[model samples]
Target: MLHHWYISHHHLYIPPSMTIHHHHHLLLLLILFLLTPPLSTSQNDTVSCPLNFDLLRRLVGSNRPSIDSSTVCRYAQQALRLVESDHLRRTSSFVPPPNTAESCWTAYQAVSDYFYPNFDLRRNCGFQTNWITVPGCMNITNRQQFENKISNSSLNAVVSACNQSLTGSSCSSCTVALSNLQASYLNGESVGNLTDCRAYPFIYAAAFINQLGPTDRGTAVCLFSLSINFSKSNNKHKTVIIVIVITVVIVIVLFGSAIGFWYSKRLKKLNRKRRKKAEINTVSALDSYTGSTTLIRYTIEDIKEATRNFSRDNIIGRGGYGNVYRGVLPDDTEVALKRFKNCSAAGDGSFAHEVEVIASVRHVNLVALRGYCTATTPFEGYQRIIVTDLVKNGSLHDHLFGSESLRANLSWPVRRKIALGMARGLAYLHYGVQPGIIHRDIKASNILIDENFEAKVADFGLAKFAPEGATHVSTRVAGTMGYVAPEYALYGQLTERSDVYSFGVVLLELLSGKKALLSLGDGQPVLLADWAWSMVRNNTPLEVIDGGMAECGPPEIMEKYVLVAVLSSHPQLYARPTMDQVLKMLDMDFPVPTIPERPMPLVAGIEDIERSVSSTGSAQLSTPRGYQAYTFEMDVRLASKEEEEGKC
Candidate 1:
């Protein structure tokens, strides 16, 4: 049997499957292969590729006025090095960046100067480009796409066969696998390119190595670097042993260095955390001074100094989750700083939500956020604070029920203005805003009063945004007991109407100068909502007006305010008027809807409202377009005054 032989680059290659006896005859084969002139074949047939040095040397020698082959080969070698340094590079997988076809054009032209003027090298361009663009069939940019085209087992086999450290049968297997892999892509179904190009084993290895990472590139380059004599692979004992020993030493040093690096990083991280704690513990106190008035995220140190280190004397208002301090900022601007009591994650979540809501809204009737601070320290744990412009007259609750000294003789006209201002604030939250906000904690305390007694709604920590087209958002109840709507307080069913109900309770307090929960001789507290409704139902609405007002209003106006409050705080969910309706009724642009008959059990908890709602099955509530009363029909005895003023 006869076997064909070929000289591939400097290394002579034979099919791994072919067995040759008496290797001494191989010398004759090499002589015959090099002595033969270069030849070409069709793309499908086996094509003989030239050696890198020999290809350039032969081109120069083939010229009529033959230039030095050695000088031309040197230029080609330099050109090959520049190709790797400049043209071939890693790129983003999503976008395949432009690769100038000129890169291949330039490398060849760099060595083409030695050719005879009449004999240009353009015809051998494709063959010459293949010299540097080995394994050119693969697309490195779309790695996942390229890898998906080949089977996993075949790819793994190819990788192992082409390992740089391997030789002999390994090299033969690699060559065969590479040909099959290369041929597989030539059927017009490849990733980067579909057509076949002639390439020797060394050039083929260079193209493949371009796609590999550093270590693999080096190892694989070694595979092509070796001029392996298949018959004599076993004879390179000293070389193989040296390669194995070097690989082992390099790996050991790498592993030891990696372990040391990991420990170093961990130690630095621990030290950083420890240093942070120390810094917080020893943070120096800051001195107060006038500075720029521009609002910014004030640091925790700035807050402490401004509030006199949170002295009790500085505290102006106290609430459920935080305390408000009357502070003079560095700019000499007066601000009410609220420092939260709870520092847990849930508190931070609420703090973030409050900031989000406060930041989104901007209205004259709403408290403006001057600045806020969030700090984490070992001493205070987590500090969440917000600063707002200090209301000159304090909160509505302070004027209405606070000590007499805080009260500035509020006349009925001023009271009415305050009432209208509060209505406008709640109205904006309900109607003007998209996905309206529900001021869940709409009570006297959250209603701040300015020097002109203009109401500014404050404390949005308990507020919730009413989603568009949503009837209600069921959530855990989060409002003050007296101000909380019956449905939300009991069932956790929240809606914009819940805020309307809370607003009604606040309205009654403003109109009557009474607390939301009016305490009688009995231990049970009565809802001011029921008491006002009972008085109005008895045709004695004037009795609900606050007598302490500087001046009394017209009977009709007083009666109208009383009627609006009763309807707004109506126990039945559908009976209560919305803030928009309340505003219209307050301004007397529209008549107050008839007082909805609240059921007898006024002393019951929020659960009583649920029962009242079920009783009015499928009853849709609607407001009159103008000065006409829309009446709600109900059959029930009104709760006694004693019962109305009992437990909420």
Candidate 2:
């Protein structure tokens, strides 16, 4: 009779066997029987064993007839007991086959040895280890691909690469890999933990387990469920489904939160922009516009041609509107063109207002306004064309101490005359006109001098229309950096005294022959007024005079000029001497001391300069002195007197 081996939920059964003596076959049967329970609990239905019959027939067919059925059956029973002893679950009762157990055991052993012992496998078996490992694990779904890579890499090297130590507390890389592993599984992506062998071993393991191949029996059971009760095996399907659903919910919540945060920030930015726009609009609406005489328009092309295409070479000076360019008209008359900035909307309005106010008011000491180009073009947005009479000697800054030659010629008498001319121009703006205009941005740069070295106050872009009803104009404050008064800069108050304060700074610059602000060796900023005030308070006022200036005049004259400048430049506006007070100072007399040449430190070629001027312009240097003047080297003279006068 043929023998058989049977496996069921209740037990493993070995049938009585025919005699066969094959050592390898006997060992195979023993191993298989050992892997299953000898006794079976009555959990399900039983079946007859076929292993006894198959083993007997194969042995006889191979001409091996020495094996005994009783011996095989006994070996199978012992192996089954050993396997059952290792299992954590209890054994159950089952029916035994009639054939010898040896035959069934041999058959079972052959199949078990074929698949199990050839590869390394690890079972967690209720341990705390991160993952379970399996070896020689053939895939039922993708067997060929897995086997190909297995031969390509050494077993230990592949294992070692995956089992690398994490080593550090910073686990951001590990966390990202874990997230990607989970996301890929949820997305139905092909993931194999061991196959990919990512840097993180555990993440790779998770993917591997997820994609593992089912056994042959598993495939049959799984396929049958498709036709039968597919939803019955919750363990086989529901775990992955739950993970996918949770992942989707998390992604949706995160996306919604990100969008909400972005919208909130965008709303705040929009609100801030709206508030700023409203503030600017209110200021523009409240701006007084009654003083404007007429509105004019000009193309950018026309203005460019007038000012040599806005060339740097043509820039005589700069103002709030833009650069003042020296240009000549088609009528052969010279014109001072004030080109307003293309980007400045507020400046455009002020430029128009200046043209109206300056064009109507005529004064000899103030720079004369002739014509304007209110240039408007589709390409340029807006442009201002201001035509004024050109002064030949550039600004007062240039003539005072600008060139080696000019400083030599800037004798005491000439400086006094320039001071008086500046006073007269300021007085006219302060009290001489219809509605006294304050030249808000008063500085050496704004004061133009003719070839004869007369001061002409210019740049009234910051000028305010002070009429009967207005006590103060609530407007944006504007002035040059060092010339700005502290109160005006802080409060945006427009008044005539603000102009006086800036003029005082200009006066201090004149007295010291230094720029209003200077950076010293230790990076300290020294304003000219503060430095001069220090000298004045120390009673060493002559120390503040320019080297070239010190030698050109007597100590007594220099002292008087220093006192006037210091009084004008006092920090408090009320403490400052007015232009009228300044004029009186120029006319006042003190006992003339034996005016000795004051000593001074050497500036660049100042010693040579003083030696030269003392010899040549000695006669011209003998007059009484006034406020000191800062100087520059750049000559801003227009070529001809007729051209200059015609432009004004």
Candidate 3:
């Protein structure tokens, strides 16, 4: 009886009612085929594959059992190495001969008979459609590429139309079965006039590999399959040996990878623990400086969200310390969020200083300390954040010496008002507060101004409080270069006078319309104070006055300003007027006493308040107020009245 058999993949499907005779014949053909390898360990010899049926029989020999002629032809067609790489190479090269169809058919049969039974073949090979057209097949260059497209493409949906149809094991089994079928065909196995089914798949796989360039990572998988060839009687043994070797190698790789992964994970966990411990230690130290106040921790997420995710568009300014971003609070109040460098050497201390000083202090002239946030939220990489009231109109430095348009617009009256406001702010910092806070850094930049030209002392990050009876504070020298006091800058001796000196520098900057550090040619560094002093000494001080001041204020008013600047910027610490003295000078409420003409007191107060002023004549207080004038006559009169009252 003649029967039709078609091999789709590795499966060898036979139709029902093929007859018991065919079944017996098929089983016998499988059992007695001389293509089977010997059990002995000695045979490692290579044998050529049969190009025809006569050659196939000659290879099987007389000791082999009877095998079907068609099966023989199929085996021969499927026995060649269609996909292979050099022994050392892991990647596969898919270069096909002119007759790709013949080779692919042989590959199909090889894989089919080798891995799967007839039933599996019947189910998968139900359709003999043009599975891999050149265009469709060549598109998949690598295994990963193929798997990716297949997952999203109709191939995956149609291949197993049902939901949850395949597990990992089942999928691997299917791949193996299909691979065997393809191998069988590529081996030159033929069925009737259909040529070999397996050879076509190999050609298809090869065509794809060719397009993906040699450097493609996926080509290794295709080459992996070609390393094993089953042709001689002992080929089965060789195949088994190779499979065992591959399995052992795979197991070793998997084991090593597992160990490596475990170590990496363990190291990561240890690092996390160490980092957590370090953070806890740091928080503990920071808390020591804070009293009765709970530090508000802000998660990185909270900060990002609060600052609109630290958007670059929201950035207001950048300083030596860190960038300042604009943030809107939950209540819709805008604030300037100063972010400190995470890895900065002084970030922790600076944060502590700002929080400690700003939290407890409240003053109108001082920038109101709103609130701050630390590592309070679950966001990543956000640790230190400080929120302060947003000062609009930018910094005082901007208005004093900003763009030409800005400077021209700042009237002399406004400039004087800003200077007065700044003085009051410093006065509050120096003595107005209960604990007497000293602003370590007092510069134009630190003085923020509002639209109304109201000066607010800002950036108290370096501020310190003077303890009772402490004349000077010993600290690490920290301040802007030019504004830093010579005493503190040279010898780390911080005192209220240091701020006086810095304020003096700012006053000079204000009057001169130039930075405190300026150059006037001749290699002479024209420090604002020295230049202004020289101008005053030469009586040409009006030339140094800001032109804006020149236009708005009276010439005489500018001369008084020159006097104020000279008094404010006295080189000697004792000579410099106190913040209170400066305020009085600005307001002109106190009289300008005549100097001694030779050597006079650097600081002259209201000692000669009631005395008349005369040029070149020294003023004296003959009987100052609150001094007792003892008179015996007035005492005797009071005693007589007392005696009379007692007698009555």
Candidate 4:
């Protein structure tokens, strides 16, 4: 009966005597059951011992008669205890201990080994294989993809529970735990404890049973234990490789930092050397102008501090030369600072030339040069700055046509006064100085009005001295387009007459209240000089007068002033009056000179003359009586035609 019972239970036919002799197998099984530990009382325990014996019986099968049912029970019991203990430790009410994620992952690996001892975990587990290792489980390579998968799986509930229960500090502790697990797994270490492994038993069972092979149950169990040891050996090798990589990275970072520091220091030293060289050049340049007692030398630092480091708000004007900043001196004197544009040798020459010219001249109508500065700083390299008196009323161009407020204040008498003051200043520049100076750029914009409504001619950057016994200085043309005289613009022959001609253009602009260059809305620009000349030639000089003028004194005086302006701006350089004669005409010092007939060749328009002057600074001259002779020739030809018709 005992042999029959063994055959029925084990599904094997064993002899009665063999069963009697191996009766100790039952006793050994009993002892094994007695040695197994009981389950913990923790509420968070995931596995309970004494698992379904029927399920274990089916999983092991009756292939080996040497192994009894008790051994299978013992192995299952041990695995359950490990799973239960790990779950309890992980879900403990205290703060998470170190290596919690690693511990959880190892428990899951152990469960996988128990279920599928000889099967490849990656192949058999399908998508569930990642749960066997923390690095693979976490999907560190693509976190969003992992998250999306988790959201669609049963594991989502576990993640939601952790998020809902954890505070910010606890969450950070959890993150550290996960990071440690990932690091260990990357080094091929098996996590010893994994709390979430309890949830994957069903998945593991499904994959394990699908690939189960007919094998000895004892050997299968032994292989699972050996795999754990093998994993540990591989973990040590991976750890060594990881350590070497970290050390190499640290050494490289230290070397790179040292190189960066050395490069920074060398760059700073080079900048210091360049700055010192610039300062030396600046000092040498200023020394050349020290012989002049009138010129005051200033340092770059002083100008910067006075102008608030050249702030945009301090800028008063901008032109082709550069920006004009309003600044205050150490002596509490307000001044206009003209910072030049170019920093080349040509710019330096202009700066030095201007200093020499303004420093020598002393006239009320001319702008006073208070001081000068040459700076070569690291930021603004080799700068040339000129300081002049800050005119309160701004430029003549501003008052004549700028804003309505300015025009309202500038009465006709004030305009006449400004006109006379400008004439006096130019006359002084032409005749009062021994060698004389020709202001090549004489326009309304350059004429500044003072606090007392007096005119002061500023910007001597273009001024040149007329040498003794020389009629004109031949040089490159440099002046505003419409204001340049025909002789100077065409032939590059700069003379006192050229300046007189420019003044005449300004005078005409003032009288007519029009810009020197006027856009006629016909794709052609007309010169104020030509327009005034045409008005005078047509016997309508008063028509050219600005209607904005309130008190023009007398029509006769105004007309005479207009006639003098026209005669001074004649196309023929010889026909134009001198600065002295211009002043006399403005003051009614002598009768207005006879207005010459319009030169027929000169009637080609100002635009044409400008084009010709720009190309070659001289125009082809016509005879003094060229216009009269042409008219006479036309009349004689007409008379001959009339006599022929009468004969016919």
TM-score of each: 0.48, 0.44, 0.47, 0.51
lDDT at 567, model 4 = 91
**Model 4 TM-score?**
0.51
Alpha-carbon deviation at 280 in model 3, angstroms: 4.2
List of clashing residue pairs for candidate 4: 103-193, 103-194, 104-193, 104-194, 105-194, 106-191, 490-617, 490-618, 491-617, 491-618
- Number of the top-ranking candidate, with lDDT as the measure: 4
Candidate 1: tens digits of C-alpha lDDT, residues 575-596:
6767888888898669875453
Task: List where candidate 1 sits over 4 angstroms from the true fold.
Answer: 1-295, 405-408, 601-648
What tens-digit string does per-residue lDDT give for candidate 4 at 513-631? 88887755865556677778889988999887898776667888888888988998876564677888888878866988666443332112232233344333112222222222322
Which parts of model 4 are misplaced by more than 4 Å? 1-288, 602-648
**Colliding residue pairs in candidate 1:** 525-646, 525-647, 526-645, 526-646
Which runs of model 2 end up more than 4 angstroms from their true locations?
1-305, 308-312, 318-320, 343-347, 399-403, 467-475, 519-521, 588-648
Clash totals in order = 4, 45, 62, 10
Candidate 4 local distance difference test against the native: 0.59
Order by TM-score, highest first: 4, 1, 3, 2
Candidate 4 worst ten-residue window by lDDT:
222-231
CA RMSD of all predictions: 33.4, 37.3, 39.8, 40.5
- lDDT values for all models: 0.59, 0.49, 0.53, 0.59
Model 3, span 1-648: residue lDDT tens: 668864333345678969888888776665555455546543443222222213222322332322233233323222222222110023322222223443344444544443333423223434232221121233332344434433233333323321222221222222333344343323332332222333333333333323432122222113111111112447578689879999999999999997997799888878777756655655675566344554454456666787888899999887655688988767788888877654322235556667777766667778876556657345445357777889988886887777877777567788788888888889878887767788887888888888788889988777898887765777765666567654464346677877887887887777768887666786544457756766776778687677655356777776676667665665434345678877787777664321101111111113222222321111221112100111122234334532332110
